[model samples]
Target: MAVLPIVITGEPVLHTPAAPVTTIDDDLRSLVDDMFETMEAAPGVGLAAPQVGVGLRVFVYGWIDDDDVEHRGVAINPELWLSPLSTAPLHEMAESEGCLSVPGERYPLRRAHRVILRATDLEGEPYEVAAEGWLARIFQHEYDHLDGVLYVDRLDHTNAKTAAKAVKRAGWGTPGLSWMPGVDDLEG
Candidate 1:
C-alpha cells in the first residue's frame, strides 16, 4: 500500500460533494488499504478519500490507545446514525479536532458524544458499529469530508478566525479559506 499525498486546503474538490461508491471491487479494496497506510504514515487518527484527491465516499480509522496494537481499517459509503438520548448510550462532547486536508492546524469542534454507523467494509461486507468519545468524534469528522464539509466549517467563529489567519499565512489554497472553486470572485 502506498501513502498517498493528502490534498490540502484550497482545492475545489474538497468543497464539492464526494461521489458515492457503488462497487466494492478489488480496486476499492486497494484504495482502502492505501488509505490506511497513508493515515498511519502521517500518524493521524483518520483519513478520507477526498483528502487524497479521490472524491469518493470512503474513509478509514480505528480506536487506538497507548497500546502497541494499532487497530485500523477503512469505511466505504459510511452513514452515521446518532443514537437517541433516551435509550441510547450516554455520551460527552469532546472538542479537539484536526483534518488531513486542512494540514498543520487543529481546531475544537463540538461533536456528538456517541454515534452509530452503517457502512461497508473494504471487502463489501456490511457492518454496524457504535462508538463514543474520541473515536466517535473522529468518525464524524471524516464522514463530514465525504459530504464536502471540513472541520474548519464547524469551528466556532473565534476558532475559525484563528485558522483563517494560519491558512492565509501559509498560502495553501486547495481546501482552505482562501480558495473557492466555483466562485470566481468571492468578494463581489
Candidate 2:
C-alpha cells in the first residue's frame, strides 16, 4: 500500500460532503489499505477518505487505549451518534484538537465524550461500536471530515479567533494546503 498525499484544509474536496461507497470492490479495498498506510506513515490515530482526496465515505482509525489495548478498524458509510456532551463549561469540556489537514495548529474545541458508531467494514459487514474518551473524540473528528467540517469549525468564538490567527500565520488560509509528512502531534 502506498501513502497518499493528504489534502489540506483549503481544498474543495475537504469542504464537500463525501459520496457514499456504492460498491465494495477491489478498488475500495485498495483505497482502504492505502488509507491505513498513510495514517500510519503520518502517525495519525484516525483519517478520513476526504483527507486523502478520495470523496468516498470511509475512514480508518488506530489507537491504543488507556489500558494499553490496541484498536484499529475502518468505517465505511458510517453514521455517528453522540452522547449528550458534558454539561460542564465549554472550557472544561473543550480540549485541544488537531487535524492532519491543518497541520501544525491546534485549538480547544468541545466534543461529545461518548459516541456510538454504526457502519460497514471493509468487507461490507455491518458493525457497531461504543466509544468513550479519546476514542470517541477520534470518531467525532473523523466524522466531521465526512461532512466537510473540520475541527476548527467547532471551535468557540474565542478559540476560533486564535485558530484563525495561527492558520494565517502558517500561510494555510489560501486555496491550497501543504501536506505534513508526519501525523499530527497535537492532542485531540
In terms of lDDT, which candidate is strongest?
2
- Put down candidate 2 lDDT per residue, 5-73, tens digits, no spaces: 887778888889999999999999999999999888877899999999888899999999879999899
User: What's model 2's overall lDDT?
Assistant: 0.86
- As for candidate 2, its clashing pairs are 42-183
Worst 10 residues of 2 by lDDT: 179-188
lDDT (0 to 1) per candidate: 0.75, 0.86
* Model 2 CA lDDT for position 180: 41
Q: What is the TM-score of each candidate against the true structure?
A: 0.82, 0.92
**Candidate 2 ranges with C-alpha deviation above 4 Å:** 91-94, 180-188
Worst 10 residues of 1 by lDDT: 179-188
